[model samples]
Target: MFVRIVKMSFEPSNIDTFLKNFEIKKNDIRNFEGCRFLELYRDKNTTNIFFTYSYWDTEEALDAYRHSDLFKGIWAQTKPLFNDKPQAWSVDKLESLT
Candidate 1:
């Protein structure tokens, strides 16, 4: 499994709008092929900071989703809300306790 995390910092006034957009499209993104899991988290100390945690079957699967029309539509709406360039990383588990 591939684990992906994306950290985003949004403009203060855009936080609510960003959450609304994310909520509207979250299900469709989670249901995409090879998507195993999806979730969003907000920073307790920073209201405009958020993170997205997701799992995919493989890097190729995630790439395919990134290139899809759904991604384009969602991203177009999402990009303008950013206060900073987003950070993203992918990992494969080597060990787990649970």
Candidate 2:
């Protein structure tokens, strides 16, 4: 399986708007082809910081999603809210204890 992690830092005033948009779109993302799982995380000390942790079937599958209209739409609403350029990583799962 392939894993994707995205770190996002939003402008203080835009945090709520970001959260609302995320809530509306997350289900569609999770159900997108090749997506196996999706989750959202927030930094304990940084209220404006968030992360998306997801699993995809393969790198190609992830790439397809990135190029999809769903992603374009979500990103259009999301990009303007960021306080910093977003960061992302694609990785292979090394091990899972449980």
RMSD of each: 0.9, 0.6
* Local accuracy of candidate 1 as per-residue lDDT tens digits, 64-91: 9999999999999999999899999998
- Quote each prediction's TM-score: 0.95, 0.97
User: lDDT of candidate 1?
Assistant: 0.95
Q: Candidate 1 has what TM-score?
A: 0.95
* lDDT (0 to 1) per candidate: 0.95, 0.95
Q: Write the per-residue lDDT of candidate 2 for residues 29-59, one digit (tens) a residue.
A: 9999999999999999998999999999989
Q: After superposition, how far is residue 55 of candidate 2 from its true place, in Å?
A: 0.2
